[model samples]
Each structure stands twice: as structure tokens, then as C-alpha cells.
Target: MNKMIALMLAASASALLAAAPAYAQDASYKSLTDKATADYKQAKVACDAHSGNAKKVCVEEAKVARAKAESDAVAQYRNTPRELGKARKDVANAEYDMAKAKCGDRTGTDKTTCMNDAKAAKTAALADANTGARAGTNVAQNPPATMKENCDAMDATAKAACMTRNAASSTKVAVEDSVITTKIKADLVKDNDLKALDVHVETVNGVVMLSGFVPSQAQVKKAADLARGVEGVTDVKNGLKVK
Candidate 1:
């Protein structure tokens, strides 16, 4: 009778063990379903709260969030992981769209500036994600290093020239900064009486080339010195001869 009781107890324990996984799986499915429902509700709320272009963006984000939540539910219900990564990528794309919408209108220089700022922010985020994916490993953020590895890298002089070109392109956008031009004129006219000499200031590549004639050497030097003192002026060429 003790032997039979022991056998019955063993069978009961085995049956409980066999049932545990299915119970846990059902619980997981319920949790995921709850979470998905919550996410869908939140997204709908967000969609209702926005308007205009922002409304469009909000709706897109909401859709992505809902999709991701649903995908998670499916994965949990089916005990599968295949579509989870794709859902994550869709969520990332949604985030990117939201970021772009935050940057506002891109019609002119403002748009270009906004896009550049957004690009920088995206690059930083990508770098952070890459680092996290690597589990605390460090990665270089420089693109030039990758270029050098891929191609026959230019010599130091050529590299310097390339840097100069890139800088020139950046500076070209700021060429419309009127403060620098105003300051250049103010310093040129300050202290020294410019009433007698017709002076004009022309800037090329940050080099101030003075081409007006002044009455005396003192006046010429004064003008050149003033031009040189202006911020952003690289060099002042004293092309003015004493009249």
C-alpha cells in the first residue's frame, strides 16, 4: 500500500510539472494583451491631442506604437520572436519621424539649418545605440577614419585642403550674418576720421582687402589696423596708397 501511495504521489507531481509551462504561457499572454491594449489607448489619446502637421505625425507615432504592442502580444501568445525586431525597427522609424516634425518648417536656410541639427542629433542617437548594442564597447564617431580605411587616404596637405573646403562650405551659410559686416564697418570708421577718405571694405575668404586711397600714411595704417581688429578678419591687405 505504501508503494502504491508513493507511485500515485509521483504521478501527481509529474502532472503538475507538465501543466506549469502552459499555465505560465497563458499568464504571459494575458499580460501582453493587457499591455497592448494600454498602448493602443495611449496612442489614440496622443492622436486626439495634436493638430495640423503635428496631428499627422502624432497619428503615425500612435500607429507605430500600437503595431509594436500588437506584435509583442502576438509574440507572447504564439511563443515566437521572429517579428519583434521588425516591430522595433518600425518604432524607431516612427521616432525619427517625430523628431523631424519637431524641427519645424524646412523651406529655406532655416530648413537647412534645422535638417543639419536633426542630422547631428540622429548621429548622436545612433552612436549611443551602437555603443549600447556592443555592451559598453567604445566606437569612433569620426567618418574620416572609415574613409581612410576604405580608400587611398590623401596626404596631410590634401587632407588639410579637404578640411578647408569643408570649413568654407560651413562658413558660406553664415556669410549672411550681418553682424560681422556691421562690426567691420564700425571699427573701420571708429576714432579715425573717415570723413575725408572714401573707404570701402570687401571681404573674401575672411581676408579683408582694402582698396581705397587715403590722404596720408597715418590714415592708411589706421584703416588697415582697424580692419585687422575686426573679428573674423584673417588678414588686412593695405592696398591703399597715400594720395
Candidate 2:
């Protein structure tokens, strides 16, 4: 009957509509992956211009860029807040790895401090990411309970110092440095003239270190200027090389 044909056409339209979003998501995922791959390749090519510890650092930076891009792609495909938070954590871990690699170029107390600062930055970033994930799920945010447990093994005086140091490090300088680095990175990403992927940003005690590769001396100056403009950035160590 004519009514049966009308029903069939309506069902087909409904099915098509239901499939459209999934197709769009798949396309988006592919696009992100393609861009990530291209960026990784470009970053690796930049690494070819360096040697020794600098070369190692450059390779780690390239890996960090690729990890961030891939994680972002997955997060977009899932379209969930938790996935986005996980993507952030993934990027933090990549940055941590790169930071440790940079520390290999130092020695003694300097290297120790570098490693500690890197760990602190990672912890602050992970904590923020966890809070974001919980907030997205309508859960209350609290400092992880392990923070207290970690100090429990020490004696009274040591424990007090440990707790004080942990509290101060977590809530003050490390957090501020992380915020500055993030803002600078966001700014760089927004600037069309900068190859944001080719630059690695690291902050410690308000000092921002701009590393990795840039194409021109102007961009090197632009990056340092951008970092210096960020709030809480006391100084910029422009290690960015013109390639």
C-alpha cells in the first residue's frame, strides 16, 4: 500500500540520520590522525639538525608532540570528558619524559633539582587532569589520599618537613610554573606564524625555557617575547635555535 511505502521511506531517513554523526566522528578522527602523523614527521625532520644531548632532547620532543596529537585524536573520537582528561595526562607524561631527557645533560645538584622539578610539574598536571575528570563525572574533587600516606613512613620531625615541603611544592611554585607554561603554549598554538609543535616549553621556578627548533631568528625572538609576556614568567632562557 502507499502507507507502507511512506513508512519504509521514513525508516530509511531515520536510519540515515542516526548514522550521520558516527560517520562524522570517524572522519574527524581520521583527520586528526593524519595531522598528527604529518606533525610528527615534520618534528623528526627538525631533529636531524642537532647532535649529542641536543639531538636526544630533540627526538624526545618529537615523541612528545606525536603522543599529544595521538591522545587528542583518541579523545575527540570518544567525545567524553574523561577521555579528554586522559589525553591531558598522556601529554603530561610525554612532557615529563622529555624533561628527564633534558636533565641528562646536567650533573649533581642541578640534575637532581631538574628531575625534582620535572616530577613536580608532572604531579601537578596529573592532579589537575584527575580533578577535571572527576568534575566532569559530577564527582567531588579532593586531593589524592596518597599524599598523606607518602609522608607517614618518616619520623615526626622528618614527617613534618616532608608534609610541609609537599604541600608548598604542590600548591605554590610548581603549580604556578605549570600554569605559566600552559598559557604560553596556548598562546603559541594560537599564533599562526609559529610552528607550535617544533617548540618545547618547560618551566621551573618561574623561569621558562624555550627549546627545540624554529625556522627563523624572528620566530626565536617572538617565542621568547611571548613567554616573557606570560604572567609569573620571571625570565626566558631562549634555547630555541634557528633552523
Candidate 3:
């Protein structure tokens, strides 16, 4: 029937509309991956212009940077917490490669120390990233019951005072959060290392949240580092996806 055909056409249109964003996202990430690949090739070629230890170091750095970029691109394409965690791990791995290569330039106890420090740094950064990933995976956990227990011990007048103070504390936290967010964003706009990042900055209870894409692993760390340097920021949680 004519009506049935019209309905079918409408359904097909609706399906296509629903799929548009996903398609666009896929296309965008494909472009990112292609550009990263081209850039990696150029960098690797530049490394060949050097010789000996310098060329070795350059080659290692190029490979590491490329790996990090690919991992980040894949994570952005997937846009999942698990993938993001993997990207962070890839960055740590790349850093380790650079560290090992740099250590190659040294000798004796200095080399040993450099290797040890590199391993420690890699371990710490990967552990931190995995900790966040685990937290994201299991959001439902035992919440402390201490708050209710303490409230039960309070008399009526004390309970009223506690409520008033808690309300005031929450308001103070909000004000501080807003101020810190503004300051951090302003500072980010100023710093050359961070200015081009255009990262999303948010704050809650003095903790800062950074989410967006940065050009490299260094910028990822700089995002959180810059936010933490702000006067009122209590902590920084980096959700910035690396390019």
C-alpha cells in the first residue's frame, strides 16, 4: 500500500539520521589517524638524517611518539574508559622507551640510576592510570557509614547547627570551585605549553576535571599540573584524551 511504503521510507530516514553522528565521528578519527601516520613517517625520516647514538635516540623517540599518538587516536575513536586507560598505558610505555634510550647515552652508576628512575616513573604513571581505570570500572562500592553514625550521636540543637554549617560549607565549596576553574582556564590560555590544548576544565568541591584532546603526552600531564598549581584547587583528575 502507499501508506506502508511511506512508513518504510520514514523509518529508513530516521535510521540514517540516528547513524549520522557515529559516521561523522568515525570519519573524523580516521583523518586523525592518517595525519598522525604521515607525521610519524616524516619524523622517522628526519631521524635518519643523524648518525650513531643521536640517530638511535631520534629513531626511538619517533617510534615512541608515533605509538603514543596512535593509541590516543584509537582511544578517541572508541571513546570508552577502557580504551582511554589503554592509551595512558601506551604513553607510559613510550616514555619508558625514551627513558631507556636516553639512559644509553650515560655510563656507570649514572646509567643505572637513569634506568631505575625511568622504571620508577613508568611504574608510577601506569599504576596511577590503572587505578583510575579500575575506579571507573567499579563505581559502586561500599560507602562509609560514619556520617550517619556521627549524626545519630548529635543532640537536636547540635544537629541543627551541623546542618547549617554543612550548608554553608557546600556554598563555600561551590564558590571556590568556580573561582579555581576560572583561574586555571585563564592560566592555561596564557602558558605556551598548555594554551593550544583548549582542554575542558571543570571543578567540583575544589577538585578539577580536565577532559579534551591534547597534542601529546607532555600536554596531558601539563593540563593537570597547571590546574593543580592554582591556589584553591585541591586535586586534578585528568580525563584529557591525547592526540
Best by lDDT: 2
The TM-score values for the models, in the order shown, are: 0.34, 0.56, 0.62
Model 1 vs. true fold: TM: 0.34
Measured by TM-score, the strongest candidate is 3
Model 1 ranges with Cα > 4 A deviation: 1-34, 45-50, 60-91, 104-106, 134-243
Worst 10 residues of 1 by lDDT: 136-145
lDDT, ranked from best to worst? 2, 3, 1
Cα RMSD to the true fold for all candidates: 24.2, 15.0, 10.1
| Model 1, span 59-101: residue lDDT tens | 6556555555554454334422233334433444454554466
Candidate 3 local lDDT, 1-243, one digit each (tens): 999999999999999999999999899888887887888789989988999888887877776667666755654465454765676677677767766777787899988987887787677658755865675421112112232234456899998887676555555554665688779979999998888654656554566767544568888888888888999777887866443
